[model samples]
Target: MATDNKTSAILHRDTRFVPKKVVGGKGSYLFLEDGTKFLDSTGGAAVSCLGHGNEQVNQMIKDQMDQVSYCHSAFFGTQVAEDLAQLLVDSTGGKLSKLFVVSSGSEAVEAALKLARQYFLELPTPQSQRTKFIARLPSYHGTTLGALGLGGHVQRREPFEPLLSRNTSHVSPCYAYRGKRDGESDADYVVRLAAELEAEFQRLGPETVCAFVAEPVVGAALGCVPAVPGYFRAMKDVCEKHGALFILDEIMSGMGRCGTLHAWEQEDVIPDIQTIGKGLGGGYAPVSGILIGDSIVQTMDKGTGVFRHGQTYQGHPVSCAAALAVQKTIQEQSLLDNVREMGAYLESQLKQRFENHPHVGDIRGKGLFWGLEFVKDKATKEPFDSEVRLSSLIQGKGLEPEYSVSLYGCSGTVDGIKGDHLVLAPPFVVSKTEIDLLVDTLEKVLKDVFASL
Candidate 1:
């Protein structure tokens, strides 16, 4: 298994990168082939909430493999999937009781989009009345054709514009830091965002709108931006008034990442269809799924008598087992408290390190998921020129000698192309010492980069 170095066949993230092959991981560190250890601060795009190589989760996977490796959802339903669904439903207090299993976050999001479409089809309205979806600019749902269409990330969609569906419409995201007008109060900002959504539905003909898609806490696209108070409540009202379903994509922001089991819980609103991943399986396995409310399930239950769309690996046994164990660990061990505690510590450390730094314009996020927004001018909140690629620069600098932190890079936070942000979503099990060290390492790297500039 070792010798054939015949030009790697896999498509690396960066073609120029001969990335040091990772040999193994333990705790929060990833070990490379050269025996170098790097702290995985971003958890590979925030997926590994439980950190690497947890014995409990590993053991659970082994037990499941020994008992039963795979069970096709079409002809059979495994106890693992059933139990996992039950646990998730109980977590939601039965609000979202039905489940649709998928292997990835993108798949989960695709299911949500289809489910939302189906939800509207089940409505008494005409087929043409339920064909449009509303999403926010600078947002990301997933990468599949359907989910990508639902997303508003300009750069990601630019190449696929001709192929994407034309039924989707865009609205301004609730990004108070960048979208809120000057002199606008929090309430006013929320109202303005809601009005924009309402207007979008109107422009698209409210009757033709199937659902409104959004992230409860904007992840990746806007760098963990949360909405202003009452924002979701207002948006939910608008959707309901228009006879449209509210679909929340919490694939990156939910499942205890935002100090609660669900990000929507903090918004004082619940979606008709919810998409969750990342923290769901804590990266112990490839697990992501849709949580369906009673209304949507009842519609399908009474109309088609079966969910029309499904996957071959839906409710995968091993995936379900790993997820169930991860969920149980999060609950039984009381990890939410750690998320809050460590999150606060991380926030304080970040503020102490970058609050007054000239280029560090914004330090925002909740729980352990945080972001650092770089700027050329802090007063006007002007972003660093896109050519500078501050996020990428910091990422590279972080991995240099004497600094082994891995930072998540993102672009287009401002007006879809100008801003740069580095997101840090460390494992929920991160310690205060680790938080301190991470912040210190980040501050040093920032200083070095700024000084060079």
Candidate 2:
């Protein structure tokens, strides 16, 4: 696969192969170097919310570059950063008091973890023993060491186990499709999950726990699985009971990607600290941020008057300008309204197409973010062996000439090594026609892959 000079030039995610080169992109399609255009159904891991070749965002980057691009956070601050931060804070109705901008989701999460610990330390009654975190199994936060420690994806953390922080522990996620017992009511399931969290806190000596971190809508590791109704509120109650912060990792599910600007908004719960990324900069620039709530901010303000952490490029001017433009465009264009409308259309189309498929065990998600979990037997919900790489096959088939669609596929949805699922997160600008094409292409790809299997 790397026989060609271009393919061998750089080390890709898998050294065994290099993907086709995409020369350009426009709207919802990416043009390969060979002239084939593939529909970007997954938005490149749900990052490109505004789609490609956005003229306004590109112009914004250039304009910012002409003025100032890089400014060290410790030495100076930029208006672009302040404006973006203010907009983010305002969007949350001041519930989130401050924004700590960073380059990626992992960095944002790392900052959040550190901030949580610092918040406890800054309290009038210091919680010096509060050093541990409780995260959900089959969840993904980020790749950085600190963020990875807070995640619960077994396979991902396996290789780095020796190096991971022992301060973190895992709990079962609120995965109704798998976790809920037969004939169990949603309320009962919520109670069960909440009890499990409370048990974990007690087991860890509740006073030693700093936070309970999770993605409101589980991403890559669990394939866009949303919490059961009232699940987050219950989980937050447990956290509050233990005096631990509730941190929501909204990297792949926020910034209007999940109908609402923040995924937690739909859950009747607000996190004390939130990390947002992916769609924040709309793939126009590398940008992510932590939304610090009033309690944390006020504690810092009254205690040290400064956060102990700082990054050299904490708020790169160009990145801030690009994100500002992307966010403003989302608001001025009222893209959330489109997201809701198109999301409903997409959901209905997917159910109509795959609800009865033998291999499709479950179809779940919210807004434009949706996932299809495949299984060997739909009734039994038995997943194909991980060695089969069913999700990867489906993803590869989408990029073929006949299908021409890009899908996000991941393994280990069940227990971090046994389940297969594909995620589809089209851009907010997706039209009904495009949504139909996406579903049709996905259906064809699934059929083709299953036929071969």
Question: How many clashes in each structure?
Answer: 0, 0
291-385: candidate 1 lDDT, tens digit per residue: 99998887777777566789988899999998999999899889999999999989888998789999888888989889888889999999988
How accurate locally, in lDDT, is each candidate?
Answer: 0.86, 0.91
Query: How do all models score by TM-score?
Result: 0.97, 0.98
Off by over 4 Å in 2: 1-7
lDDT of 2 at 6: 62
Model 1: residues with Cα > 4 Å off, grouped in runs: 1-7, 124-127
> Taking the tens digit of each residue's C-alpha lDDT, what string does model 2 give over 1-453?
123546466777877667778899999989988788889989999999989999989999999999998978888999999999999999999999899999999999999999999998899888899999999897889998988888889889999989989999999998889999999999999999888998999898999999999988888998889988899999999998878999999999999998999998999788999999899999999999999899889898899877989888799898899899999999999999999999999999999999999999999999999999999988888999999999888887787777889889999988899999999999999999999999888888888899999
What is the number of residue pairs that collide in model 1? 0
Clashing pairs in 1: none
Question: How far is each candidate from the true structure, as Cα RMSD in Å?
Answer: 2.1, 1.2
